[model samples]
Every structure is written in structure tokens, then in C-alpha cells.
Target chain A: MILEPHQIELIGYAAAFLTTFAFVPQAIVSWRTRDLSGVSLGMYSLFTFGVGLWLIYGLIIEKWPLILANAITFALALSILVLKLRYPRK
Target chain B: MILEPHQIELIGYAAAFLTTFAFVPQAIVSWRTRDLSGVSLGMYSLFTFGVGLWLIYGLIIEKWPLILANAITFALALSILVLKLRYPRK
Candidate 1:
């Protein structure tokens, strides 16, 4: 079965929301508690860069889901990265 | 500039690798260090199920990047979820 552009967009939105929100709690918890024990510095660094690339890719293709999701994810990931650097596990 | 199927696949692959690998360090660190202080239980549960949905969506769309990325991600996320439950932050 072929899907129309809107249908595809719907899938994209669903995917985007799910993936993006997944990181919210991580960011909030880290910020509130000032804990970085389970966070990997390397991972967040790579992830922040990766999400930025994804945002660019999304813009190139004009996919709203990709752009919006990556934009927010980038922020969240960056925040966690900052926290990780600020408070290293002792 | 219009992109061919192959070009689109390239973007997908790039996105998939970056996003998927982003979680690798998290999983490995959590496993090795057995630290869950920074991990959010609600986040992982939602993420695990969300990635599973993404995998299904990818399968339905016949997109290899989505399928492969989500497959690996699901496993990694699930592992983290299990760890979250097994070793809650004290």
C-alpha cells in the first residue's frame, strides 16, 4: 500500500515525537539533581553533533518532523552535555 | 536539488548511524559502571516502546535505515530499561 505525503508526514511526526520526548526526562533529571553518573560525556557530545546534522538534513529535505525533532533534541542533548562537563562523576 | 533514491538513502544512513550510535556509549557505560543515577525510569520505558513502534513503522515502510537503526536502538534501549529496573538509583 502506497502512502501519501501527509500519511508519511504523520509517521514522521509520530517518530519525531516519540524519539524527541524520550530525552526530556534525562535532561530534566540531570538538571534538577545535578547528577551525571549514568550520562556518558562522549555519548552526549556525539549525540549533540549528530542531532544537529540531522536537523540540517531535515531542513535540506524540508521535512518538518525531522527539523523540529532534531532542533529540540539538540537543545536537550546539549544541556545534558553541559551538565556532564560541569559535574563529572566523582 | 532533487535527490535520487540512493542519495536519500545516504542521508537516512547517516542519520541512522549518528542517532543510533549516540546511545551506544550510554548503554555500555551504564552496563559497565552499573550506574543509574542519571537515568530516568519514565524516559526509558517510553523510549523503549517508542523505538519499538519506530521499528514497526520502518518495517512497514520498507526503509532499511529505519528498520536497522530502530532494531539496534530497541535492544540498547531495552537493556537500559532493564538496568533501570534492576538497579534503581538509591
Candidate 2:
């Protein structure tokens, strides 16, 4: 199936939006409850670092979807990572 | 700054590998502990769905990096989500 450039970009944006904002609930939950038992420090640590790299990669490639998504997702993931560190399991 | 196509793709793959595998620790932790206290259902629900969309988008766009990364990430995320549902916070 052939797709116009704009259509393809639109799809990319949609995908980016969903994936990026998906972390919001996680961040909010962690922040409010301060429960880090189920939250994996290793996962968030690596995920945040990876998202940062994705942001850089996006900048290098000049892809707005990649750049915007990773930028926001990085912040959210970092916040969760911080929470995990702050309130480790007792 | 000019980057060769291969170089650009290399960065994408690296980013993909990180973001995709970042879920490994989370899955393992959740699997072993079966604790969903800190794992938000809303987040996983949305994230798994989003990753599924990413997989579809990658297939449509024929982007191998997206396809490979999202496929693995989706599996990992879905597993976590299932674990979350199966073992809700006590």
C-alpha cells in the first residue's frame, strides 16, 4: 500500500504521541504513592538512558517524531527513575 | 552535519536496541516478584497498546529498526502488563 509522505508522518506522530504519553500514568502513580517495590531500577535506568540517546539520534536525523517523543518520554522516565531511587523497597 | 544513510541507520538500531531491551529487567523483576504495587495498570495498558501500534506502523513503513525494536518491546511490555493484571496490588 502506497502512502503519501504526509500520511506516513502523521502515523509516526500518532505512534510517538501514544508511546511518549504512556509513561504519564506510571510517573503519577510512583510520585503519589512512593511505592517503588514493583518498579525496577535497572529497567528505568537503562530506559531513561536509551531515551536520551533516542533524543540525540532524533536531533541528528532531524526527525520531529523521534525528537519530540523521546524528549518528553525521557523526562517522564527520568522522573520515575528518580522516584524509584528515592524510595527503594524496605 | 552530514551523516551517511548507513550511519543514520546505525544510530537508529542502537537506540532501538536500548529502548527495546530496557524492558528486560522490568519483566524479569515482575516475573520473579509478582509484585504489581508500583507497576501502574494504566501505564502498561496504554504502553502495550502504543507499542502494538508502533509495530503496525513499523510494518507499514517497512522500517526494520522500528519493526524489530517494537516487536521485542511489545512482547516484553505485554508480559509485564499481563503480570500486572494477574497479580494486582494487595
Candidate 3:
């Protein structure tokens, strides 16, 4: 089925805005607790790498929606990844 | 610049693998903490919604990369969103 242009644009906007701050809640909690005990550093490390790949895919596709969502998510994922590495389980 | 089909496939694989488990680390942490205190439900709520929109976008575009990434992400996001709501902070 075909989608209207506006509908597609709306998805793009939603994709951009939503994924941007997706990591905030976790970042804040991880920051506040300063505890990485329960947090999976290994998983996040790989996960962040995975996001990196997605960002590249987005770039390759040149789809604004994909690019925008991954770009924001990549940053957030990277930040959280740093924190996870910096502070391992106590 | 134009991209080869192989390059694009590589990206699709990467996107799928990366985002699929990207949420695992965070999910495990939240599960362990059971503390929604530091986590932001508002942000996650919107964030999940955002991912949902992206999934729609992905489906609409029929870009395997977009569809794969968002579908996995949507599931993870939804899981986290549920946890955030069910287990609100003290």
C-alpha cells in the first residue's frame, strides 16, 4: 500500500525526535547510581558497535528517516557505552 | 555517491544485528534495579512512541534495513516502556 507524503514525513519526524533522547533515562540512572553492577557492559559494548553499523547503513541508504534515527541513537548509545566502560560492576 | 548492492546488504546486516540486542543491556539493568526512580518514563514513553513511528516508516519504505532495525528496536523499546510503567520509582 502507498503512503501519503505527509504520513511519511510524520514518521521521519517521529523517528528523529523519539530516538534522540531514548538513552536519557538510562543514562541518568546509570549516572545517579554510579553502579554498573547490574548493567551489562559486554552487551552494551557490542550493542553500541551495532548502532555504529546501523548509522553506517543509514548513511549508505541515504534515507533521511533511517539516517536521522540512527544518528541520534548512535550518539546516545555511544554515551551510555562510555559510561558502562568507565564504571564497571562494583 | 552510488552504493553497490553488497555494500547495502552489509549495512542491512549490521543494522539488524546491532539494534536487535542494543536494548538488552539496558533491559537487564532496569530489570535488576527495579528502580524507575532514576529512569524517566516520560522520555521512554515518547522514545518508544518515536521508535514505533520509525517502525511504521520502515514498514512503509520497505527498506529491510529500516524495517529490521525499527522492528527489533520497537520490541525492546516497548519492553522497557512497560517495565518503566509497571515498576515506577520509589
Candidate 4:
């Protein structure tokens, strides 16, 4: 069965929202507690860069789901990365 | 200028790898440290479910990028979730 374009777009949007919003609580807690010892700097660094690339890819393809999701994700990842850097887990 | 399908696929694969692999270090650290106090269970639950949905979406679209990325990401997320449940943060 062929799905409508709008339906496909909706699925993409839903997916984007779920994946992007999932990072919210973690970012908040990390910021509030400033306890990133459990968090990995390498992971956040790679994640941020990756998300940035996804955003670029989205832009190249002109897909709203990819663009919007990666935009928000990139910002969140950056915040986590900044926190990780500020509070080194030595 | 129109790009080849392979080139676009390459971009998708690259994006998927960066985002998916980003979790590797975090998963490893969380597993080794067993200190998830900083990790928000809500976040991981939402994330895992979201990734599962992404996998389903990938399957529906018959896109290898989403399929492979979400599959790997789902496993990693599951590992984190299990750890979160097995060792709750009090």
C-alpha cells in the first residue's frame, strides 16, 4: 500500500520529535547537577559533530524532519558538550 | 546540479554512523562505571522507544540508512535502559 506524502512527512516529524525530545531531561539534569562524571566527553563531542552533520545533510536534502530535529539536537548536544568540558570528570 | 543516488546514500550512511556510534563511548562508560545517577531513566526510555520507532519507520520506508542506524542504536539504547533498570539511581 502506498502512503500519502503528508502521511510520510507526519511519520518523519513524529520520529524527529521523539528522538530529539528524548535528550531534554538528560540535558536539564546534567546542567542542574553539573555532575557529568558519568557522562562521556568523547561521546558528546562525537554526538554534537554528528548531529551537526545531520543538520547539514537535512539542509542539502531540504527535508524538514531532518533539518529541524538535527537543529535542536545539535543545540542540546552542544550544551552537554560544554558542560562536560567545564566540569572535567577526572 | 543533480547528485547521484549513491552520493546521497553515502551522506545518509555517514550521518547514521556518526549519530549511532556516538553512543558507543557513553554505553561503554555507563557499563563500566555503573554510575547512572546522572542519567535520567525517562530520557533513555523515551529514547529507546523512539529508536525502535525509527527502526520501524526505516523498515516501512525500506531505507537502509534508517534501518541499520536505528537497529544498532536500538541495541545500544536497550543496553543503557537495562543498566538503568538493573541499577536504579537512588
- TM-score for all predictions? 0.86, 0.90, 0.71, 0.87
Q: Which stretches of candidate 1 lie over 4 Å from their true place?
A: A1-12, B1-12
Sliding window of 10 residues with minimal summed lDDT for model 4 chain B: B7-16
Q: A34, model 3: CA deviation in Å?
A: 2.9
- Once fitted onto the true fold, the runs of candidate 3 whose alpha carbons sit more than 4 angstroms away are A1-3, A32-38, A59-69, B1-4, B32-39, B59-69
C-alpha lDDT of residue B45 in model 2: 90
Per-residue lDDT tens digits for candidate 1, residues B1-90, read 787878866775677688788889989999998888788887888788888888878887788878888899999999989998998974
Instruction: List the candidate numbers ranked by DockQ, top first.
Output: 2, 4, 1, 3
Over A1-90, each residue of candidate 2 has an lDDT whose tens digit, in order, gives 788888877776777778899999999999999988989999998899888888988999788877888889999999999888889973
Using TM-score as the yardstick, the better of models 1 and 2 is: 2
Best candidate, lDDT: 2
**Model 1: clashing residue pairs?**
none
The models' CA-based lDDT, in order, is: 0.83, 0.88, 0.73, 0.85
Clash pairs of candidate 4? none
Top DockQ hit: 2
Q: Report the lDDT tens digits of candidate 3 across residue range A1-90.
A: 677999898777867776677677767777777755555665678777877787778777677766776677778777767776887654
Better of 1 and 3 by TM-score: 1
Tell how far residue A89 is off in model 3, in angstroms: 4.5
Badly placed stretches (over 4 Å) of model 4 are A1-9, B1-9
DockQ, every prediction: 0.55, 0.71, 0.51, 0.65
Tell me, by TM-score, which candidate is best. 2
